[model samples]
Target: MSDASAVTVAVLDDLRQESEELDLLVAGADAARWAGPTPAEGWTVAHQIAHLHWTDRVALIAVTEPDAFAAEVEKALAHPGTFVDEAAGELVALLPPGELLTRWREGRDRLRAALGAAPPGVKFPWYGPPMSVASMATARLMETWAHGQDVADALGVTRTPTARLRHVARIGVRARGYAYLVRGMQAPEEEFRVELDTPDGGTVAFGPEDAPQRVTGPLLDFCLLVTQRAHRDDLAVRAVGPDADRWLDIAQAFAGPAGPGRAPKRGAAGRGDAE
Candidate 1:
C-alpha cells in the first residue's frame, strides 16, 4: 500500500479501537446509568452514545451517497442548534438501553467498513467542509474519545490516558484557525508553535521552532480544551503569545457554532477567562 493508504488504515484501526473502548463502558449499562447526566449540559450518557450513532449513520451516508448527504446537510442548516440534540433525544426516547447500544455498535461497524472501502483521494462531505477518508477517520476517533470522556465521567470512572490521544491533539492543533474563524475573528497569519507533552513523557511538537506564538502543555489537557470537555481553568495548558492566548479561549475541534464550554469547577484556580 502507498503511504497515504497505510496511514488511512492505521487511523481506521485507531477509530475502531476508540469506539470499542467506549462501547465497553456502556455495553452493560442499565436504564438508570444510561440516564445519568454527563458533563455536557442536558446530555445523558445515552444521549452521548445516541449522538455518536446518529453521526456515524450520517457519515456513512456521506461516504456512500453524496446526493443523500446533501439532504442531511440541509437539515443541519435548517436547524443548526437543535438538529443534533433532537436526533439524540429521539433515539433515546425510542430505543431501550440495550437496543440503543446495539444500534450504535452496528452503525459504527457499518461506518468503519464504508470508510475503509472508500476510493483513494476521494473527499467526503461533512458539516464544515469536505474531508478525506483519513481525515474522516481521525475526526471519528476524536469524537469517540471526546464523548467517551463524558461516559467515563458519568460512570465515575477514571480512564487511563492512551497514545490514541495523539489523534485528538493533532486535530486540536490543526483547528486553531477554525477556532478563530468561528468566533468571528481572523486567524493570525503566522503559525503558532505547539509543544505538548505526550502521555508517555515524550513531546509532540507542531508548527515551526521559531514561531512567535507558542502553546505548551499536556497533550491530554489540550485535547480536553479543544473538545470542550473540561474547563480551561482546570487544565494546565498555557499560551505564550496574545493570539495564542486568545485561541485557547475559543478553541474547538468539532464543526459548527462555538460551543458553550464547561464552567470552571468550584474553587478551582481560575486560568484567566475563556469563552
Candidate 2:
C-alpha cells in the first residue's frame, strides 16, 4: 500500500475500534439506562448515541453525495444552534433503545465503508470546512471518545486510557486556531509546543521545542479538556505563557460554535497549574 493509504487504514481502524468500544458500553443498555441523563445538559445517554448516528449519516452523505450534503449544510445554517439537538431528539423520539442501537451500528458501518473507499486527495465538505478522509475519520473518533466519556460518566464507569486517545489529542492540537477563530479571537502568531504524557509513560510532542508558548500534561487530560468533556480546572493540563493559557480555556476539538465547557467540579481548584 502507498504511504498515505497506509495512514488512512490505520486511522480508520482506530475509528472503528473507538466506535466499537462505545458500542460495548451501550449495546445491552435497558431503556431506563438509555434515558439516564448525561453531562451534556438536557441530553440523555440515548441522545448521545443518536447524535453520533445522525452525524455519521450526514458524514456519509458528505462523502458519497456532495450535492445532497449541501442541503444538509443549508439546514444546519438555517438553524445553527438547534439543528444538531433537534436531529438527535427526533431520533430518540422515533426509535426505541433497541432500534436506535441497531441504526447507530448500521450508520457507523456505512460511514466506515464510504470513508474507506474515498479517493486519495479527495476532500469532503463539512459544516466547518472540507476534510480529507483520514481527517474525517479522526474527527469521528474524537467525537466518539468525547461522547463516550459522557456515557461512561452517566453509567459510573471508568474507561482505561489508551493510545487511541492520541488521535483525539492530535485533533485537539490542530484545532487550536479554530478554537480561537470561533470565539472571534485571532490565534497567536507564534507556534506553541505541547508535550503530553502518554498512557504508556512516553511523550507525544507537537510544534517546535523552542516555541514561546507551551502546554504540558497527561494526554488523557489534554484530550478531555479539548473535547470539553472535563473542565480545565479539573484536569492536570498546565500552560505557560498567556496565549497558551488562553488556548486551554477556549480549546475545543469539535467543529461548531464555542461549546459551553463543563463547569469545574464542586470544590475543584482553579485552572490547571498554569504559569
Candidate 3:
C-alpha cells in the first residue's frame, strides 16, 4: 500500500480499538444483562448492538452497491420521522443474544475491510450527504464511542476517556451549523471558537482564534454534549455568546434529524463527571 493508504489505515485503526472496547464490555455479559435497559429509553443492550450491526450492514451496502443504497435511501425518505427507530426495533427483535453478537462482529469486520479498500477520493452516499473515506471512518468511530457510552452507563462501568475523543470533538465543532440547519434555523454567520482540554493535558482547538463566540470545556464533556448523550445543563462546557449557547443546546456531531437529547438525569447525574 502507498504511504497515503498507510496513513488512512492508521486512522481506521481507531475503529478497531473502539470495537474491541465494546466487545470487552459485552463479551461476558449474561443474557439478563444483555436484555437489560440502557440509557436510551426503551432500548436494551441488545438493541444497541443490533442497531450498530444494522447500520454497519447498511453502510457496507452503500460502499459496495450504490444503486441498492439509493433505493434504501428512497425508502427512508418515504417515511420521514420514524424510520430509524422503527427499523432498529424491527432488527433488534429478530435476533437472539448470540446471533446479535455474531452479526455485529461479522458486519464490523466487513465494514472495516470495505472501507480500507475504497479509493481515497471517492465519496460514499449517506443519509444526509456524501462522505469521503476519512470522514466515514471518523463518523464510524464517533458512533461506536457514543453508543458504547450508553452501554457502559447501563452496565455501571466507567470508561477511561482517551485521545481518540479528538476525532469526535472535531466533528462536534464542525457540526455547529448543522445543528442549527437541522432545526430549520439559519446558522449564524460569525464563526465560533472551540477549545477543549484533552485527557493527556494537551489541547485541541477549532474555529477562528478571534471569533466573538466561543466554547471552552473538557473534551469528554464536549463529545457527550455534541452526541446528545448528556444534557447541556449537565456539562462544564461554557459558551461565550448567544449563538454559541444555542449551539451547545442542540449540538449534533452525527447526521440525521435533530436528536431528542437525553432527558436530564434527576439527581447527582446532573452534576457528576461527564466521562
Winning candidate number (TM-score):
2
lDDT of 3 by residue, 1-275 (tens): 77777766876898889988998999999999999999988889988888788888889998899778998788788888777777778877888888889989999999999999998788899986688777778888899999999999999999999878988998787777778888999999989888999989999999989988888889999999999999876778888888887778789998888999987756644542321
- What lDDT is reached at residue 18 by model 3? 91
C-alpha RMSD of each candidate structure in angstroms: 1.9, 1.0, 3.0
What is candidate 3's local distance difference test score?
A: 0.86
* Clashes (N, CA, C under 3 Å) per candidate: 0, 0, 0
**lDDT (CA) per prediction:** 0.90, 0.93, 0.86
RMSD of 3: 3.0
Considering only N, C-alpha and C atoms within 3 Å, which residue pairs clash in candidate 3?
none
Q: How high is each candidate's TM-score?
A: 0.96, 0.98, 0.93
Ranking by TM-score: 2, 1, 3
Best by lDDT: 2
Error of 1 at 150 (Å): 0.6
Give the RMSD in angstroms, all C-alphas superposed, for model 2. 1.0
Give the clashing residue pairs of candidate 1, or none.
none
Model 1, 1-275: lDDT tens digits are 99999999999999999999999899877889999999888999999999999999999999999879999989988997889999999999999889989999999999999999999999998887689999999999999999999999999989999888988988888888888877888999999898999978899899999998888889989999999999888888888888888888889999878899998885446574322
Candidate 1 residues lying further than 4 Å off, grouped into runs, are 266-275
